[model samples]
Target: MDEQALIPDSQQGDLNAFNRLVLAYQDLAFNIAYRMLGDEARAEECTQEAFFSAYRHLGSYRGGSFKAWVLRMVTNACYDELRRRKRRPVIPLEPLNDTDEEIESPAWLASSDPSPEEVVHLKELDTAIDHCLSTLLPDFRSVVILVDVQNMEYEEVSSILKSPLGTIKSRLARARQKMRDCLQGFEELLPSEYRHEQEGK
Candidate 1:
């Protein structure tokens, strides 16, 4: 069934309908939370919280993009997490596995067909991008992630962030520029071939 149909059922207290919506957008919710917070564990928590909040507030949801509505809830949860982290900062120790081996990169970075060199290069690039994303102010980061990464339109992003369209565009531009600068400075860490490829672009 279309998610639109699911929404009304969900609002009417149908847990199965709501769960279908959850299955549809769970990746999106978790991805946005992750890109915003840069932590897998926290992102998972935020996604769950957003869904709970959404379920409770479904009665207030008038028509329009249900995906955007869900995004707004996820974004709010991330903002809350960011504020809490600021209030109680803690050092993050290196992650270790059951055998006590330090985990160099997240297992999610592994793929079935990539060569070892390809995997390492991809991980390095991924790290640089995440670092650049983390450096952005929350407002700028949200706009960029929603627009560039999530491929949202300006109007939808404006709705999600509750910012003016012009403001959303402006922040996305600045955020992209900052990411470029950060990554260019990080060229030393990437493979030389990848650096050349970027330069050619």
Candidate 2:
């Protein structure tokens, strides 16, 4: 059955239909939570809470896009988790004598014969991205993630975020500019072929 059929069925307490919906969206939901929280255990907890909240509130749902509804719930859960973490910060203990060795480069990066200097530059770029994303205001970061990273359209993101379309566009534009500026410092990280392309731009 299509999504429209599934929603009514699941709303009416069809466990199988609901399970199917969960299976279909669980990965996407988890990834959103993980990316937002940057902690695996916290992400899992947020995902579970979001699902349970959706299940409990299923009766309240009226006609609309079910996927978007669930995503809004998941995003809210992540925001709640972020707020709670801010109130009480706890650091995880570090592992000692770790058996796992760090690989010099990811498999995709390893395939290319990048010079060591290039590799270091790339690593710096990656760090710069992480740092900039972390520094973003929560509202702006959420917009960036929903649009740029998750590839959500403006209307869909607006619905999920309960914001105006113009607000979404403005936030997305600002967020992207911030990311661009952050990455600008690592221009040397671009592969030799891409460096020429960048210079031409």
Candidate maximizing TM-score: 1
Once superposed on the true structure, which residue ranges of model 1 sit more than 4 Å away at CA?
Answer: 94-123, 188-201
| Model 2, backbone clash pairs (residues 3+ apart or across chains), number | 0
Across 3-115, the per-residue lDDT of candidate 2 in tens digits comes to 77787898899988887888888998998877677667988999999899989998999877787899888889989987887799775333232466554434433333334
Q: Pick the candidate with the highest lDDT.
A: 1
TM-score attained by model 2: 0.76
- Over 69-123, each residue of candidate 1 has an lDDT whose tens digit, in order, gives 9999999999999999989986555567679997676544333333444345545
User: Which pairs, if any, clash in model 1?
Assistant: none
Q: What is candidate 1's CA lDDT for residue 134?
A: 83
Clashing pairs in 2: none
lDDT, candidates in the order shown = 0.85, 0.77
